[model samples]
Target chain A: MTYDWTLWIVFILIGLATTLPRASFIVLGQRATLPEGLQKALRYAPAAALAAIVAPDVVLVGGALEVFNPKLAAAFAAVLATQLSRNPWLPFIVGMGVLWALR
Target chain B: MSPNFREGAREGFRVFLPLSVGLVPWALVTGMTMGGVGFTPLQAMGMNVIVFAGTAQLGTLPLIAAGLPVWLIVVTAFVLNLRFIIFSAALARGFHGVPRAERWLAGHLLTDGVFATCLEKMLSHEDPRWRLGYYLAPSLWSWLLWQVFAFCGVMAAGSIPKGWSLEFMATIALIVLLVPMARLRPMLLAAVTGGTLAVLLRGMPLRLGVIVAIVGGIAAGFAAERWQGKGR
Candidate 1:
């Protein structure tokens, strides 16, 4: 099949954005120290960002509130799995399974 | 293989194996979404191989489908991935002695799960090399699984049922992942504040409201941290 340049361009930009940060640290070595405020900001970034992404998707559906989505239920189950088994993969699988079954 | 290469590869494989399963559903959903948005299987797989970031990849698909300008798509992705800048800086401190090439390889493998796991390990371990291996193993697995399953999902596009509601699976996985991380008051506050803001601003165009909520959450978290007298 022929290549799609449009898609290729998008992919390349994404790869660059994803890789550059990691590579920069490697290149800069000991010279790198994030600003104190930035580091402080970074500490809470992931959990906050992740919650920002997931909360709406879980609690809202079809422009209405849906706190009890099968997905959320399964996610709760997965949380239980993680707590019980302390296994990362277990919760993901169980959560997905619960979602699939519920769907 | 050189000793370091062997070590890194072994570490990579070890982490890759267990993390692979969790990534499959994520990749599959991303691939299906790509297909739904008119991306050919080849394009979808290509995006997975190149981007390798599940959330950002999924986030961009809607923009592409909506025929938004390419530059906007690029900008949005850049903003979404700004968190990596912080992640990289934190990780950089641990790699002070490592050679450039090794550092480059590690950079590619860094991800949310890997960074979290590795940082925790680093706090407990003194040896940078050991920390590298411990972290790289799981992240490498996650990356490999993500790409492989993404390709599979693309190839199986038409055959995959539409009503599977993979979005819900994504939501569940995300929630499961977030719940554990929100142990601190700041983290819990960030989640609640961000979630509320996202809901309040849901009507905003181009998902800008979500972005606003994220920024708000970050600021709140920063304030909370300062109040608690924690961190630099």
Candidate 2:
């Protein structure tokens, strides 16, 4: 239960580093313009980041690929259910349910 | 058209509702794991409050556990959150009318969900005030819920089963969010390339694979868009 002062210092420093970038252009005001190429490319950031986060989880079983696992199967169903359903909860329920059932 | 406050609030709740299921599991894992990594409860709470980035926070756990240098932790958090800069750059044009203080607030609170929800609403509504309201409403919901559940996680550590694998719920939430954002060709290309490359590079240490996949997918999607433009 001992508090690490160094870790707390690191956390604050990291917090500042994280916040500066997010507000960079927005706080820079109306005239700020990023490079045209980079501006266009920023459109892909959300998709790319989310994909990077999800892909490893779906495929890696114990940090290695397990092809027939329920997690993988449920992921596919969840993706498809997301495409077809209006309700947001359905895909998550379907995915988690499948994972639980198969496990 | 000015955004109806009530309307924005309702939309905010709707978006935040399903995502709550995802946040609790992540918060639990983060809170539970932080204690095991030598972080005191107070320090974990401090990190949660100051460093609100989930993936970056989770990533920090492993680095801290390995007794990595603080410089490395700072750099890892920096690189992981570089995407926030992208989010800011993309949404800045829409937010020009917002005051500097609020924009700074937006910067501090921004995340994948906030970015996605705000950008989506901006695309459809085009009213900065409405956009701001919608974004703020949900952003507040997420931040508060994250703090509470993460605290619960810290207090209820080890009570959660090892096999529960609640991280999957977080992934499912991410997938659901990602799917809606991928309606366009370039967006779809970005996601698919990122995913495939992620699988290819999963073995890399410190999830460096994620960094590579992010850059690769963006480059791929941007190139595809350019190729389509040439065709047009």
Candidate 3:
């Protein structure tokens, strides 16, 4: 099949974005210090981003509120797993299994 | 393999082992979605191999599926993946004396999970060689696992029903991971501000709301830090 230049371009750019961040630090070397405020901000980035993604998924189902969705229940299970086990994969597995079973 | 490489690989595997099982479902979902979007298994696998970013991959897939302009899809992915630049720069400092090839390899292996683990170790002043091992081991495993599961998803795509609520599982997994990290005030504030902004601005085109949410969260975090510093 002929390659799509547009798709290839998009893929390359995506690759660059993903690789650059990890590579930039090496290129810039040790002189760069993440500013204090930035460091603080970084700390919150994961939580904020994750929450921004999760809240809607949990609270809204099928374009409306479905507080009692099985997804939420499974998510709750996953959260409990995370807290109790402190294992990232376990909660995800448990949650997914629940979701799969309910489906 | 050199001791350092072996050690790094070992540590990486140890860290990634548990997460490997969890990652299977997500990889499957992503692969299935990619296949459903008209990408062949080869293309999907190639993308996984090259990109290796979960959130960015997920974010960009719908656009690709919709046959949106490739530039838009790429730009969206780029913007979403920008945070990795900061992560990479932070990690680069520790790799000063490493060979150029080794640096490249490390760069390829760097992922959110590995970066987090490495950062924690770095903050604790762990030995650099050991830190490198710890960081590389798990991410490499994750990379391999992602590829395998993505392939499986591609293979099983037709068998899985649509609207399987798998998205919810993925979201829940993220929430499970995120809640603990949100313990601090700045993080909590950022989450609330970002989520609220995202909802309020959902009408914006091309997911501009996501950009707004991210910017707002970062700004809020910066402001919170400044306020805390002044109080101290």
Pairs with backbone N, CA or C atoms under 3 Å apart (clashes), candidate 1: B11-B137, B15-B137, B15-B138, B16-B141
The predicted structure with the larger TM-score, 2 or 3, is 3
Model 2, span B1-232: residue lDDT tens = 2446557767876876786566666676567666555565788799999988777777556556545567766765675566777778777776757777888887788877777766866557755676677777777778888889888877775455546554465566667768888888988999899889979986678767767888898898999899989999
Correct interface contacts retained, every candidate: 0.57, 0.71, 0.54
Candidate 3, B-chain TM: 0.71
Worst 10 residues of 2 chain B by lDDT: B158-167
TM-score for chain B considered on its own, for each of the candidates = 0.69, 0.67, 0.71
Instruction: Kindly report, for each predicted structure in the order presented, the TM-score of its chain A compared with the true chain A.
Output: 0.75, 0.77, 0.71
Error of 2 at B15 (Å): 14
Sorting all predicted structures by lDDT, with the top scorer first, yields: 2, 1, 3
Off by over 4 Å in 3: A1-9, A53-103, B1-39, B59-83, B116-139, B163-169, B228-232
- The positional error of residue B46 in candidate 3, measured at the CA in angstroms, is 2.1
What would the TM-scores of all predictions be? Answer: 0.71, 0.66, 0.71
Could you tell me which residue pairs clash in candidate 2?
none
Q: What digit string (tens of lDDT, one per residue) describes model 1 on residues B1-232?
A: 3466457546645654664566666777676666655567778777877788876776666556545566756765665577788778776777766677878888876777777656654456566676666666677678777877777766666575666554344454456556776778888887778878878887888767867887888888888878888654
